[model samples]
Target: MLPFTYALRNLFRDPARLLQTVGGAALVVLLLIAAVALNEGMNSVLENSGSTKNVILMGKGSEESIERSEVPLSAESAVATSVRGLQEVLGVSAVSGEIFYQAPLHIAQGKESQALLRGVLENALLVHRSVQLIDGRFPQSGEVMVGHLAHRKLGVAEEDLAVGESLYFGDTELKIAGRFIAPGTVLESEVWFDRNDLAVLTQRDSLSSVTVRMDAAEFEDVEVFTLQRNDLELAAISEQGYYDKLSTFYEPIKVMTWVTAALVAAGALFGGLNTLYAAFAARIREMATLQSIGFTRKALFVSLIQESLLATLTGTLVAFILGYFILDGLAVPFSIGTFTLTLTPSVIGVGLITGVLLGTIGTLPPAIRCLAPSLPSALRSS
Candidate 1:
């Protein structure tokens, strides 16, 4: 059997080829890391956005989209009084009637972009435990509060969303009274206004949804209330269940991410294979000589695989460093809100496994072809 050093030394025989192989493999691993990070970050945002103790009551057919759901303005009071076992916060029933809207918000005199708007009463803070006022005070009528990432989503400078600055809604200007944060959730990318102000601006006569916080064991009571109130035409869903459904709805996008990674990785795989083929073909005589000296064909094949793995593993290290420094914690905006790309341990594990597969699978065909001929034939050919 050949010494392992033989495989290691062979990799440096052609510096340019070694660099190319490593670079190509690194790029492929990086693409895979990006894809996996995207999936992880998106799922994390949606999963953390909900709580087991909360329930959402939305229009019957609009369970999937709270923004499209509508309940009567009277339902808020009715549900608070009718629903039993709701958690109380600061002497108020933890029930919030919310209105969701998306429209072009004027950032400047002429520039405007779409932004998510939420209308809620003071009880919103009680119902959504994740929300915290980071600056100034909660919004009042004719004023609005901006989320931490609202400026980024609106394509405006962060300074433009400062506490004293103002944003336009339709023909009316609303002051930015405060800034709030809801880390790891989509709420960080929205603008909040007084429910009455939003209803007047959008001419919306009904509420978007009713959110309530209650004991998990008492969810049946809430469900039964929704069932009995045929007049409201509302459906009840646990907050966690709602977000889980949202995650499922976005499954195809994650699948598409994998598909895109596969396509790009396939291209890089061929390029790496071509490099390996050339590198190995140049070492054919050396391999034949080794075989003649009693190094078994099996040993030679193993050495070839070892050389490929070394190059690919180096590339994998570079990919991890790049992912940690550049991609991790990078905020990516979506229609609902923004999520930060996370380089979690699981994502890194996927990248490492992908690197191993690339090294092993990529070397098989080229290694097999290079050793196909007899030792004498291989030595005599070149």
Candidate 2:
């Protein structure tokens, strides 16, 4: 068997080749980390954004998008009185009629871009239990409260959406009354408006949906109500179910992300393979010499694998360091909201496994070919 020091010593024999191997592995591993983290971040946000105990009541045939749904303004009152076993706080039912809108909103003396808007009453907090008012007061008439991460979605500076600033919706100017956060959810990227104010500004006479929080009520109760209330023409769905469907809807985005990363990594992988082939081809005579010295072919092969592993593992370390600094806690904005990227245990595991596979499987072709020639022929050849 080759001594551990033998493989270590051989790694530095060609500084240029060592650099190429390490750099290629680093680039490939980093790309994998980014791709996996991105998908995880997106899925986490969408999955955590909704709750199984909550049910959304939207207009018939509008289950896919609340923004397009239109329910009568009286639906909120009807659900509260009709639905049994609803959650309540101090006798106030946990029911909220809300309007969801997306439109171009202008900052005070800044750019205009599309922003997600949610119109709700104070009781909205009852249904969206994750919401926490971190600053100032909730929005009243002529006022709005921005989500803590809303600026990221709007592509504006953080200070632009701070409390005391103002946002413009057409000719209407709404004061930024506060900042709130709903961690791990899409709500953190929306701007909340007073229910009345939003209806007036958007010229909406109807609501997008009514959200109800259940305590002892089963989903069947809600579905039964929808069926009984034929005149209302409502659709009942669990909040968690809605988000799960949204995850399925975004499946293509995840696929595209992986495809793009694979394409870029493929280029780097091929370059690394070519480099390894040349480096190993040059060492054929050395491998043959070791085999002739009573060392088994398997032992030489193991040493070559050790060298490759060392370089790839070093690159993997580099990738983890970079990912921690750059991707961890990074906020990524999408159509619905923002999600933070973290180097979670799953992501790190994937990266480490990828590094190991690249070291072993990626080295096989060149390693096998390098040892293929007989000891006599290898010794005679260059």
Strongest candidate by TM-score: 2
Q: lDDT score, residue 5, model 2?
A: 95
lDDT of 1 by residue, 1-382 (tens): 6789988998898899889888988999999999989998999999999988999999999999998999998889888999877888667899999999999888655669899999998999988999999998999999999999887788777888999888898789899999999989999999999999999999999999999999533788888899889999989999999999999988999999999998998998898888889877877888898899888889999999998899999999999999889998888888888899988888889889988988898899989988988988999968
Q: Pairing residues by index, what is the TM-score of model 2?
A: 0.99
Q: Whole-model lDDT for model 2 versus the true structure?
A: 0.94
Model 1 RMSD vs true structure: 1.6
Error of 2 at 7 (Å): 1.1
Model 1, position 97, has a per-residue lDDT of 97
Q: Pick the candidate with the highest lDDT.
A: 2
Q: After superposition, how far is residue 8 of candidate 2 from its true place, in Å?
A: 1.1
